[model samples]
Target: MLENGKLQRSLGLWAIVGLGLGYMTPTVMFDTFGIVSKQTNGMVPLAYIIALIVMLFTAISYGKMVRIFPSAGSAYTYTKETMGNYTGFIVGWASLLDYLLLPLVNALIIRLYLESLFPSVPPWIWVVSYVAFVTTINVLSMNSTSNLNGFLVIFSILLIISFIIFASIQLYQGMGTGTLFTMQPIINSNVDMVGVLTGATVLCFSFVGFDAITMYTEEAIDKNTVPKAIFLTVFIGGGIFFTASFFTQTLFPDLSVFQVVDDTLPEIGLYVGGKVFQVFLIAGAFAATTASGLASHSSVSRLLFVMGRNNMLPKKVFGYVHPKFHTPAINVVLVGLVSLFAIGPSLELITAIINFGALIAFTFVNISVIAYFAVGQKRYKTGKDIFSFIIMPLLGAGSTGFLWYFLHADAFIGGIIWLIVGIIYMLYLTRFFRRKLGTLDFDEREDTRAVEADVKVSSQG
Candidate 1:
């Protein structure tokens, strides 16, 4: 067993998904739709339903992979198992970028919302403060931050629930109401496919980090807990997001939030709670983004650990473990620095680039599940496992792939460039390609000569 250090071992279903997620996700959901209000016609909440289905299917594959392997590398481990190592290395590489800026962006969002609370301080300071503190706390390791995540999630949920109840009150009283989301704005945005995709692209942000729970699967009490946490978080979290959005949209009949343009934060808090919970709303936003940054940092660290261990990356950069803290210290620092730069400027491009990687990861996971079950399931088969793994993943992939076609041209072009760059780097690093995306391995376990060489090296050392 790994020692209790910065790494965690006991995260359950609820804590892993709920708390880490709550630390930063809600605001992403709100902001994405908030920007697309006119496009969604107050039906911005509906976008989450689509995101849920997409994430759920992908989660099925994740849960299956984690249950069988439960390692720290997340998709790196899963892809290696189902596909092979070179593919896994590429995945690990991509995942590094995904989580790297996650914290920085989260910090940035927290800073924006914090301005609502501390009107006097410069917003950038607020942002810097969140990035610093959240990094320090996460660096403290899994236990301390788990507790922090728990409190943040509970508080944020409670406040959101209150907002919902207040909205219900106003609705029941018939104080003021919109026509419950007419479809014109959604069908009619000038941006058309581009607008919807742009709006939905932001919606994708809300769905990105739910998988961070998998990186800690080795530490989880039971493998079953990780998958359950993932699915439930998608459902429950999606519900909270969609419900609040629906009500808030309806509360102000005249605003027409779904028209696909920038709008202020919904007045629902001030309308229903009437400023009593203004501070809480701000806190909820801050906590959500902070959690996002923390989760991002954690995932990136583990992905680097996997790559370095595989010898695909310069191992020494990630090879050192903290003597006392027991965390992957060097890898953590490197990830933070890379993420800080990524977060610094051109965030829209940063976010758009990251989402494409995530979507590609999702697409591959779906394909992996399909490949596993085809002839591979015979290697690891159970009747029930086949249905969820095979059936659900297929459905999830197929559904979300539809959404992918609607993606922004910038995202599409950017994603293509990112993958091409990764491929070129891998050829040089591995000393020329043995094969393409889905058929390479780093473990050396299956290579007769390579395995012998590893054993000889260990003996000589």
Candidate 2:
């Protein structure tokens, strides 16, 4: 039964981790491997390794924040409580782009994959069908959505593992690269920093899902569970990316051999496992995309719900939860409506624009950690605090700052325009700074000593 008409704390560690992995979509590494290989001179694993290192730091930073403030607002709450309301609003606005575009990107990719499999079907059909289905699942129940996500994620991982096995067999049997061991995928004489950084920026999309875990803080069974799940999600997702891309690169080391960049993995499937495996691979991609879409839908609705509950948006519309379903039905519908925009743009443009918002949010999230732990509380007792609170987050901010600086010009412009619009709207909402900001029900600070004690006991035991 629902308690006090709030989001039910139904998600345990595994379910939350499953939702995060599903959101990241392990199959995406295959979809973009060819492009990354070309940019890095076939050093896909090395670029992924670099991206993973940077992402891990941000993941730790996020884990710290979730421990401090377990709420659905995520980066917004962290920045607001630590930095200031104005700064938090800006971070929240940037996060809006990340959460909202994720589903759009997944929905668009679903249509693109379906088109590749069946060229005659209209693209809008797949987009509409996916959006409606995912939106409905989200509106009904988070538990139902999580169960569906868990099943799909397991299936997708199994398919990728199958491909790895087949690829390894082919390598041993003198196919494609004709050897199991090679260093070309990690380094080469033609290695260029610019290309590696560019590819790393693109590959960052695959790491996007881990941060979404924080959006479910209000719905988690245990506040401590969210932080552990966040770290695990990033570690597991990064492992899949590194392993799958390594084997794929080992099998298809020559980028020029690809007939089409996006279709590279499917083509390699045909070569190693023949037509049947190609069909299965396409099926796997479809499953992965669906799961990712569902995860994204769930994440964005919770974000809108938190913003609405805070009166940041129209609370009457975005904040309303269903009496029985315990979901933000209006916000769910709104996400489905906005997802229609995916039909107007190319995949490259949409994905590039997404990176801009995500990188900005990441930079601020890392900064928020420093502000909260090191500056605000001066929390430096535990040995882990020095590495996690001080050194690691600083590196995360610096690395993400570099990526933000080098974002594609189009993405930079789009992000700036979006930020400008947000500033104008916020001004109106606050009545030109004359009115104070509204707070959510769970906005009050918790007893840090008690919370930290609980977290420490949870981890130690």
Best by lDDT: 2
What is the lDDT for 329 in model 2? 83
- Using all chains and alpha carbons, the TM-scores for the candidates as numbered come to 0.81, 0.93
- Name the lDDT of candidate 1: 0.62
> lDDT of all the models against the reference?
0.62, 0.84
Model 2, 1-461: lDDT tens digits are: 12224665667899999999999998998789888888888888889998999999899899989888888888888888888888888889988987899899888888888787789988888888888899999989888899999999999999999999999899999876688677877877878888888888888999998899998887776768999999999999999999999898888887766788865768877877999998888788889888999999889898888887788888788778786676788888999998987776788877777888788888988999989988888877778887878888999999988877657888888888989999998999899999867675443344333344434543553
Off by over 4 Å in 1: 1-8, 114-124, 175-201, 253-263, 266-268, 379-389, 434-461
Candidate 2 runs further than 4 Å off: 1-4, 380-386, 441-461
Candidate 1 lDDT by residue in tens digits, 1-461: 21222243456777787654663376555455456565554446555555666777787777776666656677767777777777776776666656665766665555556555578986656655555676676565665667777777776677777777777777777755534434433233432454445456567667777777777664465556887887777777677777766676567533542342342443535556667665566566666666667667766676666566556666666644554444676776665555444324655666776776777677777767766665576633777766766777778677667677766677778767766788788887766866443322333232334334434533553
Clashes of 2: 0
Model 2 pairs in collision: none
